[model samples]
Target: MSISLSIHGAAHTVTGSCYLLQSGRTRFLIDCGMFQGSKTLKALNYGDFPFKPEEIDFVLLTHAHIDHSGLIPKLVKHGFAGPIYATHGTIDLLSCMLPDSAHIQEMEVSQLNRRNVRRGRPEVTPIYTVQDAESALRAFSPVTYDEWIEPAEGVRARFWNAGHILGSASIEIELTTGLDSPRLMRLLFSGDIGPEVTSFHPVPESPQGLDYVICESTYGARERPQMTLASRRDLLAAEANDALKDNGVLIIPSFAVERTQELLSDLLALAKERRIPRAPIFLDSPLAIRATEVFMDHADELEDGEAFRHAMRSPLLRTTESAQESRMIERIDGSHIIVAASGMCDAGRIRHHLKNHLWRANATVLMVGYQAEGSLGRILQNGTRAVRIQGDEVKVRARIRTLDIFSGHADGTALTQWIEDRGPVSRGIILVHGEEEGLTALHDRLAKKGLDGDRIFAPELDAVFDLLAESPSKRERPAPRRLQPEVVGQLDWHNDLSRLWLDIEEELEKAADDKARRVVLRRIRRALENERS
Candidate 1:
């Protein structure tokens, strides 16, 4: 029997994690995630899936992060009717997250259609609706950690705690290859490994001794300083104290799931200790508020569970559920904290808050999550003097601060250690879910550690491989890809155009007189004409 594996997403970039495996007569997917990052990547979210959805047997979800599980509703909307196997915690989070994702798309598309109408362009529809997300919810089948299950004939799989989020997991599979000889092939998919020390869970764990292992390299090129819980909280308290001084609004663009809850717990702890002022902290995103409730329900499984529960219920923590309430936050007059979602500031209420407060020198934007390349958050982090937000150019006078201590993924050193712990693999290690920098760094690090360089495979998007018993072999492309592998993580032309426009405006403003400005404009026009010719 021949078994083949295909990289659908998260191969050359850190978003849209998916893998398709085909064995004998069975075909299944590891994850059916949505694409996030540059416009070129996000465009894939609206395009057709490379494979037929109806032919997929089932889906094995890694976690509830939109980058990993966002496109499930779209899959269901198309024709997939198979059950989605996930942990109970993942299911609970997805129950709210999927619908929230659909609603956001619906709202954004509706607003976009209005603009399109004025421009006389064709109307565009959302990829999936709230009803479609509701329909997808019915297909979830919960499973427990460390339990083995057979989703198809000759296939046995088990889930291990990845410790990245509330219910994140790394999957292990055992496949029967030869019926007469009765041979077994083992593979492990390391879904986003977490740091060694975190407030919510323990270090990531998984079984060793596999034929082939697929690992995520989200932070494979960067290394973070080791920090204990108290130390991490101390850093947060300091940042919060400094930002809240002189009646400033501290805006933390946070992830809705685990990151928000973790920050809330730490902030409340600091306030109780009198380390930071007990300013009213507003949870402004409806999706984050709902996710926090799920965290509260599962507090018993976390470290310092009682403290987390207590922190979540504190009077200083105010959750704004309605759009009107969220808008009302801008009218407040005192120093406070606002925790909003879409951590990368690519979408959600964070954009609205940034637009309202970015021009104010008294405001501070504390980024607590990883910002992908070309994301609005990255653009700000790069110190752009002015940014285009929601069709308005906003001057960036607000202070931008980044706290790397709050990342959910393990860093380079920790990722190397995690891979070392999953030892003695006979076949190969396939690296995915990262950009070229991360993938190359991890590969070199592994090679320096005496692992054969040839055994480490970093496949591009849509690349196929024949998963042989001895070693996996890369196969020729069966079809052309939706995107070139080179364009996966880099800034697209849209980002370039935005930067170019900003430069032109800055040059015009710098001109001494109208004549000088006209000269600059004439030169630009000549350049454009030359390019056209």
Candidate 2:
């Protein structure tokens, strides 16, 4: 029997990157991420898991980003009693991230409950808890890069640095069945590549001898501008200098994991140089500070050969106690620059700051990360004159600026450039993690670059693709399939309708747990061919 891979999540859109893989009687999950951005995507976070959590043999994590690892505690809560695997850095980060995420979910749910009191709507409980987070972490087994481990029967796993963040990796898999005609399944899951080769870390080397490729195309439609390390520093300094005119607050909405550390390191260097005025710069967001400490613990991943040396010279300001955070907020009333988490201005202390400063026009709101659709950061980035927070619509007077060069995600041109360097790994490539616009844009470009739609496909979330044994003597290259926008428009009414064409090969009994899953997977695969054509 042939092994299979499913587009469990991050198929069409960038968030909630879960992929289900199977070989023989074994099953496992990869990157149990959460859905973010617009309501449409958020709806996915509340839906069923599709497969029985207890039945999954194990879980493998790519990194600790909320989108890639936020749902682990929830999975554990839902009966996934198996062990989880990740890198040492990922484990440390997740140790902090899981509890933080659980706290947020609980707080958000509580807030919703309060609102429900008036509306009389049903209350929604949080997906997990602090205890759940702690419970999930107990199963984590940290492995370093390039180490081979068996995740499931016939499946061999290895990790390679993706350079996206500290401990982020691209997963490599090899599987061999115990049969006379044993087949080798070699697959690479490009777990969200980083933007550049930084002084803090090395770039991801292209893998060799890959048979199938599952790549991410988050910024799949745009060209990434070349930016030097010094240029990024200069850009932020200029922004700070401009904001320091009145000695007002400089609010940078950072991702709290990688970007926050990078900013903290940069600011520490500037403070030493006395480049900008040294008003008390506060590092709020308990999660960000804790996550930064995790970075320090795993400082081996930090770049530039002297991160340890630099730490010795100028240590970080990572606060822990509640009073420390309060102190940071209180100092903001004076001439101070405050760096907080939730980079997209979605929630946390950053939102409180925005509530206070949105109408002041004295403060500066600087964004240094990607702002997904429907996020407060995007609303401000779009030049919205006014915005709402919590309940009040605050007038926009604060200076709004976004510096994209500091973003961790690789843009469209970079992703294509990386794919171009592939040395015959596999002709068939599937692009994941992007909006429909981004995916469609990338699909057309890849086609022009000689990877026609038949050779390279961008799948929709929950979409499925079938692999058949390749002919040894006569292999035909697949032709580009024309986009059926009209058909796609019709699909607005009903989804995955192509299952009507199922034949005897539509074996649902052979799939996980039920005949329905078999039918659903089969139809989802058929829908892909029609949706593209």
lDDT per residue for candidate 1 within 1-533, as digits (tens), equals 78888999998899999999998888999988988889899999999999999999999999999999999999998999898999999999998999999999999999999999999999999999999999999999999999999999998999999999999999999999965788898999998898877898987889998988999998899988879989999899989988999999999999999999989989988998889998999999999999988988998888777888888889999999999999999888889999998899998999999999999999999999988898999899999899998788888999999999888999988888888888898888899999889999999989999998888999888888888745334442445788987798889999998888888999999999999999999999999999999
- Scored by TM-score, the top model is 1
lDDT of each: 0.91, 0.74
Give each prediction's root-mean-square deviation over alpha carbons.
Answer: 1.3, 13.1
Best by lDDT: 1
218-304: candidate 2 lDDT, tens digit per residue: 778867667887787777788888887776778888888888878877777676677766666667788987887777666765776
TM-scores, all models, native as reference: 0.98, 0.84
Among residues 3 or more apart in sequence or in different chains, the pairs in candidate 1 whose N, CA or C atoms overlap within 3 Å are: none
How many times do residue backbones clash in model 1?
Answer: 0
